[model samples]
Target: MFTIATWNINSIRLRAGLVTRLLTEEAPDILCLQECKSPVDRMPLQLFADMGYRWAVARGQRGYNGVAILSRLPIEDAGDRDHAALGHARHVAARLPGGVVVHNLYVPAGGDTPDRTVNEKFGQKLDFLTDMRDAFRAEPPRRSILVGDLNIAPREDDVWSHRQLLKVVSHTPVEVAHLSDAMQAGDWVDITRQDIPTGPLFSWWSYRNRDWTLSDRGRRLDHIWASRDIAAAGHASRILRPVRGWDQPSDHVPVLASFDLPV
Candidate 1:
């Protein structure tokens, strides 16, 4: 069995120690991290490699919109795409030894306003999803896994209060529709949802909440998706919610999926 995990670290440099703690504990075969907020060269590669994650493919900017896939298993850099013509380092892909491709992405967190007309960031987010849909429609993925902080909470149960967040940037109807279209385009299966389809699941909590667990205001922003061909192999999906309570924690937590496939 192979275990893979996805997390939006928010800032890799600042939380490299936390990542080390996770690697020491969970020890997933592969870990996809988003919002690295550092150049690829500036990442703590030595630290992770020392812990046995010697292979990686990363796309990163100086201080924002970055992603990386770190693996203990052998893998090759499969490159990335500049979705929506946004030159940010928001995507990176890698191929595992047995030909499974893994994509790590950090979707834009639109500004406060839900209206594209009033919020340029919101329009960019929509455009990014549109580009993703078009790309997948043009070349459908097979035997692949996609994970990231997709930003939007597509399901009503994905958030603490869907009604209250309807007009919010991440839970807006337009954003949900766009994200859904992207999913349909690739025929991707939501691994986390498939594992636990009936409950209120979440991977992100607000730092604004003084007592986040007590308030329980969270959203299922991070996601793990697999192509239909290999989706059935996916099992034991879970969100590491307690990680959010870690020291100097990020607003997001790790989401994990285990697959009954060879390395």
Candidate 2:
């Protein structure tokens, strides 16, 4: 069995030690990271390699959006696409043994406004999801897993207060619909939701909250998805919420899925 995890580290360089701690503790076979906020060459990759995550593929920029995959297993960079023509370093893919592909992505935050007419970032977010849907429609995925801080919390149960957040950028109906279309296009199964079908689930808590755990006002922004054939092999899905309490932690936590498949 192999386990894979995803986290929006916010800025890898600023919190490299936290990542090392996670590696030492949970030890997922593959870890997908978003918002690395550093150039690929500047990433502290040697430290990861020393911890046994010897293989990796990353797309990074100076100090903004970035996505990377660190692996203990043998893998090759399968390449990436610039969805929505945003020109951000937000997507990366890696091919593992037996033809399995993993995609790490960081979707736009869409700003504070939910209305696309007044908010260009919101429009870009929708366009990104649309482009993803079209791409999957063109060539559907197989034996694939996609993970990242997708930004939107699609379900009512995904947020602490869905009714209040209906007009919020990430929880708005339009964003949810866009996300659903992307999932349907690729026939992706939400591994976490598939395992825990009910209750309020969250992976991100706002840093603005002085006592985030006490307030518990969080959203399930990070996600793990699997193609039809591979979805059945996935189990033991969980969100490491306690990680959010770590010193100088990212607002987001890690989500993991254990697969009963060969490496």
Candidate 3:
């Protein structure tokens, strides 16, 4: 069996300790991290190496965007995505052993406003998804798992207050449609959705809320998706919610998925 975990660490430099803790606790065969917010040189490579993992990173401007994949097995041929016109550091993909490819993504978080015409960030977010759709349509990966902070709650049960958040950026119709377009383009299946096809699943909580547990205005911004060929092999998908309460935790929590693979 092989396990893969994905999280938006917010900032690798600031959350190195938490990352170390996660690595020690979960020991996933592969961990795909997004929103690293540090340059490749600044990342604590030696630390993870000491913990018995090899890592590769594709980075953007420091203090802005970055992504990395850490593996107990070997990883190779890492590359970044060109989001057509948006041009953000939003994606990275690496090939692992056994012909499985992993794509780590940090989809653009549209601005608070729902109206794309008034919110340039919202427009950019849509465009980014469009580009992703086009790219996958051109060249789709086989036996792949795509995981990350997709920044969209594409289901009614994915949020605490779906009715209230309908007009919100992440749950807006435009964003949902774009996300669906990307999924359709790649013919990818949401592994988590396939398993837990029902109510109230969330992976993100607001730091501003004093009583996040009580308010529960959370959203499922993070996800794991698999190509149709390998979708049947996926199991034991979970969200590490307890980590959200960790000291100095990120607003986003880790989502984990496991696969049965030949050794």
Candidate 4:
């Protein structure tokens, strides 16, 4: 059994303490991070190593678009694919001892506008997801777990006010359609939703909302997905919503799942 968690740390350097806190407390066997915002050399690997996560694979640039996987169990560095040629360190993959591949990604937020014609970032987001679809179609994923701040809510219940957010960037129909295409191409199962199945689940609460609990306006931007071959192994899915309430917390919270891998 392996417990894995994924979170958009916002900035690993700034929130290293939060990582340590989670390591000391929840102690997931593997932790995938997006938006690390720091180079690999600058990551606190030694610190994480001290807390039992001695292995890691990462891709990063200065102050932007980074992803990493830290593991207490032995892990091998799998390739990093810059999907859509975004030229950003948006993805990194790692292989676990049992050959399960784990992908960590930070998809573009697509700016404020929904129209790709008017917004360059929005265009990039669509292209990135299109590339994801093409890549997965070319080489379908097997025994893989993908997690990240994918930046789209995708489902009606994923956002606080689905009707209100239908025009919003994360919940927009176009964005959701693109994300769904990628999922379909890879034949990935939404493990988190599979276990829970229903309800207003969310992993991201905006910083704009003061007293976020009262407003309860949040989105399920972070996700945990498994290739159909291993989908049955995924269980105990949980969103660490209380982590968002921690002091100096990231706007995003952690999403977790445990896997009972076949021997």
Measured on C-alpha atoms, candidate 1 has an lDDT of 0.94
Clashing pairs in 1: none
TM-score of each: 0.99, 0.99, 0.97, 0.99
Q: What's the C-alpha lDDT at position 254 in model 4?
A: 95
lDDT of 4 by residue, 92-160 (tens): 999987899999989999999999889999999999999999999999999999999999998889999
Tens digit per residue, CA lDDT, model 1, 34-113? 99999999999889999999998898899788899999999999989999998989999999888999999899999888
lDDT of 2 by residue, 42-113 (tens): 999999999999999999999899999999999999999999899999999999897899999999999998
Clash-forming residue pairs, model 4: none
Q: In candidate 1, which residue ranges exceed 4 Å CA deviation? A: none
Rank the candidate models, highest lDDT first.
Answer: 2, 4, 1, 3
Model 3 scores a C-alpha lDDT of: 0.87
Residue-level lDDT for 101 in candidate 1: 93
Listed per model in order, the count of residue pairs whose N, CA or C atoms clash below 3 Å is: 0, 0, 0, 0
Model 4: CA > 4 A from native? none
lDDT at 144, model 2: 93
lDDT of each: 0.94, 0.95, 0.87, 0.94
Q: Residue 229 deviation, candidate 4, in Å?
A: 0.5
